[model samples]
Target chain A: MEQTSILETRHLTREFKGFVAVDDVNLKIRRGTIHALIGPNGAGKSTFFNLLTSFLKPTRGEIFYNGQNITNMPPAKVAHLGMIRSFQISAVFPHLSVLENVRVALQQRLGTSFHFWRSTRSLDKLNDEAMHLLEEVGLEHFSRVLTVELPYGRKRALEIATTLAMNPQLMLLDEPTQGMGHEDVARVTELIRKVSENRTILMVEHNLSVVSNLSDTITVLQRGTILAEGDYATVSANPAVLEAYMGSSAHD
Target chain B: MSINRILFWFTLAVLALTAPFMVYPVFLMKALCFALFAAAFNLLLGYAGLLSFGHAAFLGTAAYLTGYTVKDWGLTPELGILLGTVAAGALGFVFGALAIRRQGIYFAMITLALSQMIFFLAVQMPFTGGEDGLQAVPRGYLFGFIDLNDNLSMYYFVLTIFVLGVGLIYRTVHSPFGQVLTAIKENEPRAISLGYQVDRYKLLAFVLSAALAGLAGATKTLVLQLASLSDVHWHMSGEVVLMTLLGGMGTQAGPLVGAVLVVGLQNYLADLGSWVTIITGGIFVTCVLLFRRGIVGELRALWKRSF
Candidate 1:
């Protein structure tokens, strides 16, 4: 009750041709909670994620961050306001060294994103801090390697590290461990736990163990509508949530 | 810098200074001018990954502006070049804005179409001398003091401008803005999610490339005293692309090496006329097939670094 809602959606609806991808959904994410969005494939989870980040414009909705309306804001501006998203797959600059990847995010934060004349090495001042963040994500050993050469799990770790460098008050991670081995999933889950300590995290996760382990709140959508919302135990016990998963699981 | 890099650059500087003494000054000047042009084109293509098929618009327009100002307005060579460069930057701003809204192949097509319109204007404009172009442009004094009429003085001036242009590009590529530009080139969606205004960076790069291309074109006019319709033709645009591709699309020194090879090929094959085009085409095919990273690019790979 004492917690504040940092991000809120007011009757968000997104229509694709004649199909409603998100049908009049409303959500209020608490200021500092690890929230998970779970849905079967084609249940409009990706579309909902896209609309929240402004990557897709909702046919009708209003998004508020803190108290400011962000439904009409561009993705970059939305990110600038401390809401940043990670891709469904790992997204890091393959040619850049891992250190440079984190440094670039920090460099943008320092207001030098448009400086064409300043030596990038001038950002050496951020080297210690960037390495510190890398170390936190268990990526310090791989700092000099090209991101493209990193293993799938490590690439996702680097994505988290880069996103962390943005100093986001709210982070949206889409399927952070989508295609990882069990060990990697554990490692990334731990990394997310560490990052979410002081920030609100909203992630779209299909991995149930990760979902149960990390999410303080779970949002389950079925065909563009909220089917269940609560803590893990309550939602898992819900008869309707079980039936929906059973229906999708049989076909999947 | 490593010792090898220092030695390489030192050798290059020495060669740049003394080559005119051994070679025909006019030929060397032409190569230097194009080296700058190709470098400018590479900034957009190599760094931004925006394949502009009509770079000649910037280069040719700058040349025409410089030629018209010197021949008609009686402006100093420096002022004429300044005007041309500014015009190219402005034009780049407009073109990049319109082009950046599209992605991949669409971006390339948009730029090509817009630059063709510029080509049409160049062919029809009275100031451009139509097909005749503005000719016999005065080189004028450097700051109204040093006479540039002397071929040796002119060679050094062109050489100096070439070095300055290359230096600008080098600094830009190594700069903070350049880092973000490459990020966009690598992954635009990630860049947007990271809060970078990717389109703005693309536009800035476009303007910078245009202005530098303008500088090269204006310098060419001073050296050759002509701005002709041939410069603005779509063929010129394709040639610049070929030069950059032959050099290495993204490497720092690729364009310079590519331009020299291209210009040298033209000079040696000049007596054969049409054979030159055929041979050039053959060389391009070979480069694309065998050394796709380009001559300098392949060399850089061997060296484990970019020149």
Candidate 2:
């Protein structure tokens, strides 16, 4: 156990009716680094992300955060501990304006999300901060538009902006660039690089280039377990990792 | 707000104020009460994405409670209405506690089942007076000073309560809490990831909505002086859904528009017995086919204003 490891999963396993999605795998996400969980389609990357966020409970495992056990804690409780997960699909409130989308998350930080009697106008002070988040993601110009109207690439950018509103210490981005043009992919890659400066990031990305460029450390999963864990230069050259990507069973 | 926005509400107020002079004031009072009921239902359906098929439970339960308090307990109109609203809220808490655990059509079914139980209880409960109802319940004096026994006074009193309920709903819709509820509706998992307790927010919306619906029901008791099975019946619950759907589920003015139209149609076509339900069903189907957003929602789409 490294002293800098902030998030640790011990024997994390998730089974869906006897079909094991995530096997007994230990994951330790170090502090202040961009970590990528890369795997083939159906390698249980999504399942692992869900388990870490407590969106899916582990069938047999324990999860810990900063030395505290968070195995059975709910998603909201996990998020309150400063971990946030983005969806593979661009997830933003469609009816709410982009500015309002970010503002909704920002309002949670102020502990005023429950004040039904108070006017949302009273929270106007949060607008500046929200706008700044949009600006960081190059979405300030589209802040007044409804989120549903945003282009696919811009929607991904908006999702990142909303996630940033939580001021999360650990950010879990699930395929942040799942569907985007080359231009959008680069733009978002740059945006992720900028936001990763102060926080720990756990991303499940399919794009090899995205994994190679953004990730400080990469854990290659094949058939629900880690095949190779190291920096890109080390993992990319590993025969087992090459075998997994080459469509051969790494276990064989 | 734009001039169209101002004109919209201003016109509505003027029509509401002057309608009693031209049409039957009693009919107007009935429309207003139903309008409030539909609006409350819309709070859960349109904004929170909750569909409770048993909303009549709150409305009917509150009617009986208000009727009991004013008629039997000799409470003032204000006290009766307050008690009814609170009782409905308490009922909402209990119902929401049970119902919020489920989602989508299942949630609706649970609520429907629960309301059916309430309906049966109303039919069997002696204090509710079963089919005979608590007839000739007094409107009593508002604050024991403004005698509501007069028809005109009662009309104005009911109108005031309607406006206040709508106004409170409007404020809630525009508030931070409303924003959170919308977020929850759009994506529950994402909302939870942002550290918001999604269930708690849903429950709050449910209770607020139930309490407002109860407020409408309580007022209706004063208007009609009767608490009966018709109020709590499953059909009444369906009727409110029809009103909201025809009006525009998410838009502010949709429920009121739907309520007024439904109420007006029933009043004018009272001579035609079963045709009213057929007409309502036809209207609902037409709205779903052409204007899925409802009348007000489509209008808002055209006008580019927040309804």
Candidate 3:
């Protein structure tokens, strides 16, 4: 298959108060595939994700999203370019109903958000699209329920639903299944797999089993640098990968 | 569309319209004016989570403009009111931009400092008549022929303006823009991530609130035929805050109920002199400590449970 890179970083680096949080990292995410970035605590995976999504401006280097340099663009503008990100913790309007939450994102895409006088009900197509997105995320039944009232796992799902409302070409999921029960983790992992069919998905996963089970390619990071990158079978068996996971073992 | 909520608001509006017949028209008019003031304040405090301490600038500025124009310039009441409202909105645009640069307590402090500066300016300005204010300002014809010198006619006119202002606020809150304001209040960062220009929304809300407060203050000046230092003082700002807090911080009807109660207390206790201040202060403390949800908020909460 021809390699079509959806997102690429050229020697990306970020420094905070004299300490390098993300150091000289190079990454390439192929179009239409699930790529997982896995590492131990303090390995800077989250910082790397932040840099990619333009939440934090990179100290050095360039980010090319679909061949456009978006090094220091604001997150909202970056999101408008078919890239959307979901937080490790659920980020949503708790006071808004599930449907309203999705509708806001849908509104952003439709360019009808600033029409203050027209009743929001007039945007029937947008509402239907929002409901469809909710349905896809299995939240259609809880459409009118306030987001704060939703179950923890369901809220996480709703976050994805909201993100999906933007119709992003590339979806960034930071620990998409974190802090979930075994059942929820499985359900979310399955959902992520289903979502990955059309859009390229780059996610940070702590659970090796989930990564091995879902990721087509895995990149291992340790101390702000990529330790190993390949298919799960090859990287998981690499001595460096094993040492990075175990610590000081591969050094000996 | 809920029957109870609809009936409740309908009944309240009817009572507000009719209360002047039973109670002193002047006192009812005062309450109506303050109700508009409190509602405007609540637009910022309740929806945007911005606690302004200089709202009196808008009120007093409008009052003075309305008073000076009607008294000295010989403008009609409606034209004078328009001039006042426009001035308030213009002031809000400038002050809101400056105040919104800082958030939380800093924003409140900035507004307070600006308003205090305006108050001192008003005290020295010759047009405001210093401490004496611009008294004996003609009420002028409401449209052209309807005389406003009659106390009952004046009360109804004030009530009509108050109702219009409140209705405007209600429409604003139910609008989609209002939802975005709530979203910003709940979590500004999240709203930004979702592509909202939060600061712009906040500034607009501030301007709208200021204009409405000006409308109230201008109406009050017409009612009393004076625009004095009391309208622009820091105490007036604090009073609005108290009204909003006493009624319910974010609830719509809270400010109205809070304003009416405060206004009525002041009218009944005017003969008690300095005790009015102490009593109002005591009520403020009690409301903050015990009845923090205010009358309408408490009622809504109760109604929600029953349903």
Q: Residue by residue across B1-307, what tens digits does model 2's lDDT show?
A: 5999999989988987777789888888999999999999999999999999999999999999999989999999999999999999999999999999899999999999999999999999899998898999999889889999887888889999998998889988889998999999998898999989899999999999999999999999999999899999999999999999999998888999999999999999888999988987887898889998899989988887654
Against the native chain B, what TM-score does each candidate's chain B reach? 0.97, 0.95, 0.96
Task: Name the runs in model 2 displaced over 4 angstroms.
Answer: A248-252, B1-8, B304-307
Which regions of candidate 1 fall more than 4 Å away from where they truly are? A1-3, A247-252, B305-307
Better candidate number, 2 or 3, judged by TM-score: 2
Tens digit per residue, CA lDDT, model 3, A50-167 = 8887778898999999888889788768877888888888878899899988877777655645544545565556778888999898999999999999988999899889888778
Residue pairs clashing, model 1: none
Query: Individual DockQ of the candidates?
Result: 0.84, 0.83, 0.43
Interface RMSD after interface superposition, model 2: 0.8
Which pairs clash (backbone N, Cα, C closer than 3 Å) in model 3? none
- Please tell me what DockQ candidate 3 reaches: 0.43
Candidate numbers, best lDDT first, in rank order: 2, 1, 3
Per-residue error for B100 in candidate 3, Å, reads 2.8
TM-score of 3: 0.92
TM-score of each: 0.96, 0.96, 0.92
lDDT of 1 by residue, B1-307 (tens): 6999999989988987898789999999999999999999999999999899878999999999999988899899889999999999999999999998998889988989998999999988777889788889999998998798999999998988888898989989888898999899999999999998789999999999999999999999999999998788888889999999999989988999899899999998899998999999999999999998999888878788644
